[model samples]
Target: MLGKTVKVVAKPRRGTRGAVSPRAARMVLAGAVLAGAVAGCGDEPIKMGAAAVVGDDRITTAKVDRAVLDCEKQFKADQVANQVRTALENQRQQQPTSGEPADCSARSAIDTMLNIEVAAAAAKAAGVSVSESQVDRMIGLMSQQAPAESIVVALGMPKQFTRDVARMNATQGLILQRLGADGNAQSPATLQAQQQALALFRQTAGKLDIKINPRFGSFDANRMTVTPITTRLSATESGVR
Candidate 1:
C-alpha cells in the first residue's frame, strides 16, 4: 500500500493576540499523527531507553524495533522495486544504474515505532482497551495488503510481525471506534472525546521538552517531517499504507 499524504496548513499569526504558536500546534499535531500510525496494537514491545509503562503492560524496545524494521524493509523494498521498474521501462533507451539504494526504511520504521509508543501511552491514560480478536483481524488485513515482492524475503519481519501489526490496528480502530460508532457518521460523544484526547495530547506534549531529530522525514508544512509521524493522505478513508 502507498503511504498517505497529509496536508497541514499553518495559519499565520496576525497580532500578538492572533498569534497562536504554530510550533506548539505543529508539534502536538505531529505527535497525534504519529500516534495514529503506531496505534495498531500488538503485544510486541517497542524499544525504549526506559521501558514505557502503560497500565499493566510494558513496551519493550525489541517488539517496537521489530515492527519498525518490518515497515522499513517493506518501504525500502518498494522504493527499490519502483526504481527498478522505472529503469526497466526505459531500458530500451538506456542502461539501468548498478548501485544500491539508500536505506531510509529504518528511519521510517523508527518514526512509526515512536508514534505508536506515544499514542499507546495516551490510550492507556484514557483507559482504552481492545480485544485480542480485534487485533488479529487488523493484522490479517495488513498482511493481505503487503506488497507481493517483499512478502517473500525475511526483510525484518519476525514470525510475529503480522500478529503485532494486527494488535496495533485493533488498538487504533478502538480509539477511532470510540470516536464514531454506528453508520450515522456523527456522534457528539465521539467528538467530545476526540477533543478531550487532543487536549490531553497537547497538555502532555507541553510537558515534554521535545527535540526534533531531522534524519527521519522532511518537516515541511502539513507533512510529517519527523520519524514518528507519517504523511497524511487526502483520501477520506482511514489507514494509509
Candidate 2:
C-alpha cells in the first residue's frame, strides 16, 4: 500500500470563526484510512508482527517504525522539536514523573497509526469513505484556527495522518447517514447521527481487538483510540507469530 501514490492538492480552509474544538473533533473523527488495507474483517492472519490489530488486519510494527521515521523527518522539515519538547514537559509536569518528553512524537506517531486502523474498520462496516480533499480541508481548518495548539499537540504529522483523520471525519457523517440521520449540523438529526455513529465507533473498536506494543501505549476502548501508557507489556495481536 505504501508503494501506491496518492495525489494531494492545497485548498482554502474553512474560516476560523466556528466553535469546533480540535480535540472534540478528534473524538468525532480519528482512526481511519490506514486500516483500509485490510483484506477483510475479522480473524485474518497478521503475517508480520503487528504494532496493532484492528479486526482482521495487522498494523505492522515495521509500518509503525516507518511512520515514526517519517514523522521525525516531518519534524525536522518544520523545526518542531522545541514545540514538542515544551508540550512533553507540560504533560510531565501534570504527571510529575510520567510522559517522557522523548516519547511525545513517537506516541503521536503510534496513536495516529492506530486511529487509522479504527477508522478503516468503522468505515468499512458502514460502507463509507474519506478522500484526500476532505483530509486536507480538515487539517487546514484546524491549522488556520489553532496553529499554536496544532504545533504543540500534533507536531511532526505526516500528510497521511491527516488523510486518516479526514477519513474519520467523513466516516462519522456517513455512518450517521447510514443510520437514517440527516446531515444537518446541530439539528436533531445531526445530533442523533453523532450519538449513533459514536456508538458504532465504540462497537467497531471493540471488535478490532486492538493491541498496542507496550513500547508505544495501549488502546482505550472508551475513546476507541490509543492513549499514552508507560507500562511495558507484550504484543497481543491475534495472528502475530
Candidate 3:
C-alpha cells in the first residue's frame, strides 16, 4: 500500500534470493507514493515478501514489509470501524470463522504499486524525468477529483489527506508529464498528450520481470512462498444442507 514515507526497509542486492536492491526500493517508493496512498484495511494480516525483479531493478523484501505495515495501519484507521458494524449484521448467521480474509481492494493497491514501480524504472531507462510544473498539474487534478472534505473524512485527518494527496498527485503528474514529452505519441499538439499516455501505457508494461506465486492468488509478481490450509468436516457435521 502506498502512503506517507514512514520508514524504508532497505537491503543489499543478493544473488540467491530475489529481494530488491536498495536503489530500486527508493525509486519504487517514490512512484508508489504517487500512485496509491495506503488506506490501511485488512483481516488475517497476510504477510508477503517482494523479490520480483524489473530488468536490473529488484523489488526488495523491505518494500513488502513496509507495504504490509502501511496496509495494516490503514485497515485499522479507515476500514476497521465500518467492518465491525457490518460484521454485527451477520452475527446471527452461521459463518466461517477465520482471522482476516484477503482484501481485494488492498490487492488492487499492490497492483498499482507494481505498475508505478515498473513504469518509473522504464521511464528512467528512457532518460525521462518529471518537472515541478508537471507535479503541480497532477495535484490540481487530484484536488478536483477528491474534494478536501471527503478526503479528510475518509482519512480521519484533514491535513493528512491534503498533504499525502498532494505528494501522490505531484509524483504521478511528473511521470505522466515525462511520458508526454518523450515523443512516445505521434499526434498534433492538441492531441499529443492523450497519445503519449497511450503509448507509454502500451510500451512500458512488458518491460518488468514478474514471477507469480500461486499461494497468494492469481497474480504473484514475486513468487513468494505459501502454504495451503484445509479442514474437512465429519459426516455428522456435514449433514445434508
Task: Please give the clash total of every predicted structure, in order.
Answer: 21, 5, 11
| TM-score to native of every candidate shown | 0.42, 0.54, 0.39
User: Which residues of candidate 2, in runs, are more than 4 Å off?
Assistant: 1-48, 79-104, 129-156, 160-162, 177-188, 221-225, 230-241
183, model 2: CA deviation in Å?
6.4
lDDT of 2 at 117: 65
Q: Please give the CA lDDT of all the candidate structures.
A: 0.37, 0.48, 0.35
Task: Give the C-alpha lDDT of model 1.
Answer: 0.37
If ranked by lDDT, best first, what sequence of candidates would result?
Answer: 2, 1, 3
Candidate number of the best lDDT: 2
Better of 1 and 3 by lDDT: 1
Model 2: per-residue lDDT, tens digit, 3-73? 11111121223543333333322222123222222212233334456666665666777776776776566
> Any idea what lDDT model 3 has?
0.35
Model 1 Cα RMSD, Å?
17.4
lDDT of 3 at 209: 38
